[model samples]
Target chain A: MSNYSLRHLQELEAESIFVIREVFAQFENPAILFSGGKDSIVLTHLAKKAFWPAKIPFPLVHIDTGHNFPETIDFRDKLVENLGARLVVGLVQDSIDQGKVAEETGLNASRNALQTTTLLDTIEANKFDAAMGGARRDEEKARAKERFFSHRDDFGQWDPKNQRPELWNIFNGKKNMGEHFRVFPISNWTEMDVWQYILAENIPLPSLYFAHEREVIERNGTLLAVSDYLNMRGDEVKMTKTVRYRTCGDMPITGAVESNASTLEDIIVEIAATRMTERGTRADDKRSETAMEDRKKQGYF
Target chain B: MTQSGYLDMELLRFTTAGSVDDGKSTLIGRLLYDSKSIFEDQLEAVKGSSQKKGLAHIDLSLLTDGLKDEREQGITIDVAYRYFATPRRKFIIADTPGHIQYTRNMVTGASTANLALILIDARKGVIEQTYRHSYIASLLQIPHIIVCVNKMDLVDYDQERFNEIVKTYEAFASKLDVQDIRFIPISALEGDNVVNRSTKTSWYEGSTLLHTLENIHIGSDYNHLDARFPIQTVIRPHRQEYHDFRGYAGRIDGGVFRPGEEIIVLPSGFKSKIKEIMVGEEKVSEAFPPMSVTMTLDDDIDVSRGDMLAKPNNQPDSTQDLELMMCWLNNRGLNPSSKYILRHTSNEMRTMVKEVIYKLNINSLSKDESDKNIGMNDIFRAKLRTTKAVLKDAYRKNRNTGSLILVDEATNETVAAGMIV
Candidate 1:
């Protein structure tokens, strides 16, 4: 009569590790979609744990929007180099230069939407049958219905209505020649779970997650970080404030919130007491109600 | 606000099956809203969408109806996962649609659920949907079943009506193989007995829905008697510092494993002693069910992916012939004679259906032996022969090691989900 049971975080970690291993076993070529965000950082950590004593079997694929925080790029390169893992960069600017996708115009313009083209192109060029992402269902509405082994059509489109029924721990990643899968090992994790796991494991993350004094402008009730990518309008005045990002995205569109939560413990506490969703401050999601869903349908991670 | 104890909270995953009319979405919405799991921004978004659609009240269903087609059609087309947490436990709700045609979806959701939540309308007591869902829950071997008699307000919060419905369900459920069953009467829309106790239901002396969910005994849900670990992959660093490091990586499906325990690798029948168990960076004294860890054996035995490790005295059946109850998931009908990919645990092999013995009628709970044509959403018992032998247990014992899915080779789509008998 063994009475052994795993706690929620441990169980979630085990499940994710299991999924990560399954991806390696089932697919000939797979990669972790590294965005330098906390979620992706945790994912890369899990992948490393999944195949301990061994280098992560797959490369880390990052879709660089060219509008990222300099700290994020540095963190990405350092982590990849330390782990001795290959890093694949899918540049949205390259896609624009190649005339595959045009850059958006006017204020609030970002390379966020154009990453889909570059991402798909990278997947095709590399022939990656499975691309593991750090997307969690609790992060957005569209993600709530996502499968652990989410199937994609040859055209890189997601048909939500006709998804194959996934059951138990058995995920069917079998696909045709041109088709691929978008696998999310952390689909069951919530934002709080991710933070708690990070704190428990002492996983290193980009410095953007902690409070820092940075130049920012308040636009439409959101604190936009003043960076080289942003074309600051005359009305938007820049000022210095202590703020931290709840989510990491393009520097021009990703908004930060004023906070003193510098440590992981403080961030977890701040989130616990927060009434707003993490993506509420993200200007990209604020563009429309189904912004995430629309972007996901177009093959954006 | 402290982070120390939050990681120790247990996880409870439950599935809810009910049609749109039964207020399934509303019940889930209420659970999220009243528990403070629903963020203000999410609530505001739902409110804006509700107002756009000319709704007098905030339609909570809009919170879960995610897809454009589902929103336009006003129904849940697939299983949508929802997460919430209390101080005591974290919950994952696999919200499955309840229309009869979507029986496959319900089965998919119930497959991994620790508990099955079947909502019954107080106005229409013990309907076909209730029986169908209960039967499906029983068939899937979900350990616990909580029958929520919803809309008690419409029935004037009558205790007698709730009791009558419970009696009908109990009598019907007695025919099924359900282990633990509980009843809760509540009005999802009125927020009575869902999260908070209601004055209207003062006659009822039971825990609220939230209380029942938080306090369910789920410690003994897993099979800890038999030790089973199916290796998903082999971890080999090959670095000069840690040369000759060969660790088998997989999640423990059943029982408890400790360092120095004697175990045998399956299929090849190689005996080895457990040297160490590593869960991430730390070394653990013991590993149990659902814990993924890398284990190194004392002897340099040859072990690869799709292999199983178990106590020599207690071993699973290794055979090519299997008897299984399968739910057809795809739109295409079953081709019994054609070869299909049968994936069990981490092992995959080609399999062919030898015979379709019978089809189980979910609503009637009867077997139709004559009809062998299995179509979408059909549950049937069949004989399968795999090209390679598989290590498996009965589905009633261990779900992780006892289930397999059949995929069509041509299209590479999962066509059926099977449970070993």
Candidate 2:
């Protein structure tokens, strides 16, 4: 008892709760940039703990690419209902329809990069002074240098070279009008930490992360789930296999891993021994060596 | 059994600071690389980068340089945080650069660190830069200081040279306020005493860097004498199950707070008794430093962010002015009259550096009272006046409430690291 301190999950929770409350206290209007993924779900869960007696004083803002998994959307709706928090979605379909953004045309076409424009636009339109995210530094190389409270200029550009010096737990969330900040509450957490925390906290996640029999096609050494978002090519063969997604993104780019790790315990064991990183399955990051860095520079959360 | 392995784990954050080209990055890289924390793909990426540069070997320093531009330039320009864990403890390494220009980065890295790892080149011995690093460590109230005499391979693992350098450092460090100091001689490039024991230097019997980190006596580092919990938010679930539950959610800043203990709120001077302490349904008997728990009082009292709850008899000094040892980090000089935001604990207030008392000559370990201009990479003592009164304690007494950072109002950049004197 005298030698006791917090575990990894508890420390992560404490640090994240501290970050979330700082965002709410510092920014005039802040929102959580939810992507309907496990990371975002964990962020929302931590936010719920941040302001317990009081409702989460901010809304869950999602930048919709209209290429999401239906199960993800279902999970989002149910979780939002359970927490009783407001949801704000910015539709890329509407941006395409309004001629705000043009849809890419190709076999490997994706709205992943286009979501940045919609996200910046949504942030500007809503006047969110601080936008909280679940981006972990250990997830990507560029994010490794990311500050907890990352400030953006009025033009919605991130200057990686000119970031604020974040010391201690003191986050300077000050920004002028038209300029805002992006806060990552779970910046220090790794993929394993997130899963372990989710399991420990009993946070409900989307069913896509669990094993299920689904028709999928193998392309570029990745198992792509068959959905309306993906048009099956002739060379691609579709078959049913027991698989669970290590990451959840749009159905087009997000890949599934061959695994029977359905339960949380199984998932933890699988992740503990897994060789590949969680982002290795996301084709969005593989588009280039610094795809995440490039998108982040243009204000992509 | 797998999830249960993380039942009781503590976190230790430490910083490594030294002069330029003292192999700070290599030491950290070796720690992570040898600990099996570096994944194969990450290692592959680093190896690929090293091969592209046409280096004879894989440059481990490339692992700590996070930014793309920094990697291309082959230097660490900012504070890059790296995480790893043994079964005993989790470690967060604030990998800071040692360049004179990046002094602000060092200050930022050392602000929240519990320990400071000061590296010394075996050839250079105790140079002027080593003194600067030690002074900053002492000023920051970093409880433990581990001075690693690196590059022993270059010195042929000479014990005489190690003894002479240790004596020189001890003579200089005696003037500072550092409480704990330990010395180890290692060759980081040869993987000596970083993660594994070195067979080359059998004379050194101290624990390796990893062993020292895992088994350091950190339980006494926290201030258990005075409990300080700053309320972060109010937690209330309006559902049927927790309809009437009102909890003050916060991270315990200092000391231990137990259930049913008599506590008093600051500024308001209101008193109450702790009704319950809840951390996710497991009712905790007591909460200490760094634990985030919600405490409901027996009586309803007004408490919000920046408000502190502490033992009634043991209270922090409420003051508007403080004397601080500040390390100027930015190229922009200190603004003596201009107001900047000061963040201490959960409280934020506007502050101004009223006077620069004296600047320390890092090389000589002497004070230069004539110098008043605080410039980049300069360590100086100054008086700061804040708009609002802050609950304060000596940095040596309570690290959480005693330290602060001065932010630039225009740029929102943290300009200086302040430790109450």
Candidate 3:
């Protein structure tokens, strides 16, 4: 008998750590895809705990689109240095320069989709049979059906219909040569779980997460951070507003919510009260109902 | 409160097993639906799919057929996971298929389940699929078995039919190793004795499915006698501020771990004393099964992946030869001479099947001794010889140390699941 009760966050952390250990034991060559977001950061922390007394055996892979928040870059570098783990950055810009992928050109163009080419190339080059990601099932519709050990074909396409059955704690990370598995140890975790885990762990994150005074413009009910990447219409007036990002992605696309939740506990409370999902704040997902699914099929993590 | 009440909320993972039309999906859908965990959009989508299929009402089976092919074929092909939470506890539901060819899926789903929800249509009493599911649940050592008599409304809510099915199931279940057996008459379509007790069934005394699920005793599911923590990785934050920090991170596979306890790491045969148990700092004094934490030891020892830690006095057997019941999943038959990767808990190693003792006839629950080769969805008892010694116990004794999965190297598919004897 004990005096303490396991909170919701503790349960989720335990489950995620259990899954991470399973991945480490099952896969030959596995890597954690670190995007420096809160979810990925929480994943890294869990991975660290999954293998205590020994360093994380797998390297951290960052699919760098070259267009990233400077704060995210700083967070990534600091975390990698402190953990004493290897970092492998698959540069989308390099892939474009190398002619492996063609860059998209448009008014609202971004390198989000092009990251898939570099990611697939990196997996092939490094022979990463299993790539652990921070993808949560509650984030989107298509992701809800994703298995823990998501199989990818030779072309790096996700065939949702042919996914293998994953039951219990047994994750099948088996793939033929030229094929790979996208492992989501946090498949059962939701956004609230991630935030609560972060709060409990006291894990550090980029400044973009907390409320800060920044120049922003309201566009289609979304607060877009005023950056050089954005094409400001004359009617869309920019004003300095205290806002915090719900999800950190490309600076040109990710939206900021009108928030004053500077602390982890505050963030958790705010998220609990919010009605819309986290992806609702991102402009990229707003492009189409199946935007995330379409990008995921092309091997974008 | 009693001492047991301290651990009131125990995790209950269960599998729903039944043939194609036994209302397995409907039962699961009803469970999730009544729990209020089904999102509105998901419900709407399922309703849309049902309407498109020309059904007069929402087909609850549409919830479990997640895959496109399964939806198109109007049958469950693979095991789908569903989660729901009630005030008492959270539930992880493994919705497994019931086709004879999908026997492996049932075994996989039931492998870690604490309960087995074996649905039997009141009209079809104790069929082969029911026997197969119940037998496999017993083989897997699922702590609880609830033989749900589904579609009771179809049989005009007949208590006689329910009683006959229970008697037939009990007679057969007596031959198998089952701890707790329960029966409930449910109308998944009409929602009787599922979420709310049915008014029509005044003769029934047992609680509803949801009520039983929320109150089932799952505290004894874990083997508290054995302490097993397979080391997944080592954490040494090399910064100057935390230069002396050294913690072993892994989930507690079995038993309880506390600070100041003496422990020995397996394979390396190194002894160490636990200095602190940290769950992301605020050092914990104790930890138990399924809790993930970092522990700093008194001395630095050589502990790496595939190695397990336990109390020095009570150690698991380190043996190469293990007898187990294996269920093959892939289309390709087992390569008798080929080496495969066998994963147990966090330990993985190359192993080979020494002999196929006997394949269980899933339909008839009979043993076929003449068969030497095991193919897809074949459940067989066999002896396995691993390249390295594994610390193991009977599946019934300790699920953490007793269960394993065999991976096919050539195809890179999880070919089979095995239970240590």
Candidate 4:
């Protein structure tokens, strides 16, 4: 037997780095989609490792929903500054203001879906041949069938049925003019894997991930953080709770779970012991059975 | 406890092949559910969908059929990946459809998998789909094969029926080139010999499917005897501190390399001694297969992407006339006169199909010498002449350096997957 066996996390890390390097080599212009989430944080860290002694070859693209937690934006800016990597923010507010996308109304309104338009427009404006995301197959049912180098048409639409067969480590990123690709470096990672990786790497994440005192309101059995983006409803009463977000997205739509897991080690334990998926608390996914699938078809990351 | 345990766990990626009626999705669903990998919300969603369909029992297949058209048609049209982990190992299942029409999808899924799970219905013993799947597994050179004889409960959990199916499969599998083959009688619906051992299967002495998957010896799955590193790209930081630092970055395909080892850069045939191997700022003494690292040479030998670094004594063949087993993946048929782009490792070059050897009949394990037309899902041996010489090994020797893909230049679609012979 060879004395070269790596731990599961190490193997996954190496695989992800290989994919990130491939994107750097294959595409003329590629950017890592940074949402300040744990997955994207790990991806950006991997990109740093992929070209160590050198800066990350690609810029970090953030499709700012404009409804994000202030802590997330602060963390995103700080990380970008620390790494000396460029940050490109595509604003959903700009898209709405420019009449490219209309804002949702009523109780469960969110700018989450509108970010796709800003994202596509940003890719077109920048002419990014590949936009790498931190999407994992274990995240959602619709994402399970996603390719590592997912292809997008000229309109940035995903055709799940006619996806190219990704064999071995050979990723085909070939596309015509005006078309682009969505490269997922960590497509094989599970939620548990991501947490375990964060713990192993000591990766810094946004403060929203850890337990904190925050004002929240319960809606549809989920605790929504009370922020400027959310309007107070008549029957919904706000309360203070020590909770942490399982996933980071728009403030109004992204839900938080009451937890005492403050440290990375504590968070890993909490995730391992939990029965609900990370996306289970997100109100946007509960809109329909194929909500994520529908959104991805329309170019949502 | 979870953190420490996760660090010791190994990862195993396996592919499953089964027809629509063979309960492939059910088997996967049972594995995930029994392992507690399925979240409560996911199960609740599946239950709601099942109620909407007015079905008495929850359709486990609905959990795997992800696409909208697939859900509407009640069949899996493409490959869907599923992940689950236990204390011992992490498992990634590449679930592919098993109809004769979707053989290309099966091949694609099996390409990266360490093991292939061939599902056979107990009622129908060994059928054509079984042969077809097994053949593809062998062609892809998957290291392990697990013949899962499912639906034993429908056959009254009869040991005799299971043994008969196992015997027929063994007879058929003997014709293939798979190294390790295990047979297990499972009832994916009743949860027999899948995750938990069944009392009804007490006569069987084998381990459960989950246990086998966890304990399988996969340490020697990679090619560690011959060192092969194809540079993905060069990392030249123009920073002031690292002005003179140049590193060739890529994942090691095979074997091990240590500092001061004499290595030869391929195609250029220039020799250099390794100065250091870096894995993200930390200097490692040695590097091996699948570990993406940066290597700095003692001498700058003009190495770039698509170039290889191997031990001076041990080297792969640098050849232009390549003979390989090709599985056509696109709807467009192979045109002998037209040129296609051949992508191997990090290298891409234009190539032409020189000759079409006999097409392999997957069902009968026979070669049809007369039918030279290679269409979608057709596996054939062919000679390809590339514009540039590529470093390669036989498909059976090293999978990473031995495999290549043909891309249709006009559409830029991956047309075929080739295994270098």
Q: Which residue pairs show backbone clashes in model 4? A: none
lDDT of 1 by residue, B197-295 (tens): 999999999999999999999999998989999999888888997798889999999888999999999999999899999986678888888989999
Can you list each candidate's DockQ?
A: 0.67, 0.50, 0.27, 0.67
Candidate 3 or 4, higher TM-score?
Answer: 4
TM-score of chain B of 1: 0.98
lDDT of 2: 0.84
| lDDT agreement of model 4 with the native | 0.91
lDDT, candidate 2, B1-421, per-residue tens:
1223345667788988754478888888899889877877677778998898899888887777776687567777778788887767778888787766666777788887889999999999988778777877777778999999999999999999999999999999888888899999998899998989999889998999899999887777777778999887677677787877888887888888889999999978999999998764557788887877889999988888889999999999999999988888777888787898898988889998898999977767688999888888888889999999999898878888888988889777778888888
Clashing pairs in 3: A51-B233, A52-B248, A52-B249, A53-B234, A53-B235, A53-B247, A53-B248, A54-B234, A54-B235, A55-B234
The share of true interface contacts that also appear in candidate 4 amounts to: 0.75
| DockQ, computed on Cα atoms, for candidate 3 | 0.27
Which runs in model 4 stand beyond 4 Å of their true positions?
A: B1-6
- Per-model TM-score on C-alpha atoms: 0.98, 0.94, 0.84, 0.98
| All candidates in order of TM-score, best leading | 4, 1, 2, 3
- By TM-score, how accurate is candidate 4? 0.98
Question: What's the lDDT for all of these models?
Answer: 0.92, 0.84, 0.80, 0.91
lDDT of 1 by residue, A158-196 (tens): 887767888889889988889999999999999999999
By summed lDDT, which 10 consecutive residues of candidate 2 chain A come out lowest?
A1-10
TM-score of 3: 0.84
Candidate with more favorable, higher DockQ: 3 or 4: 4
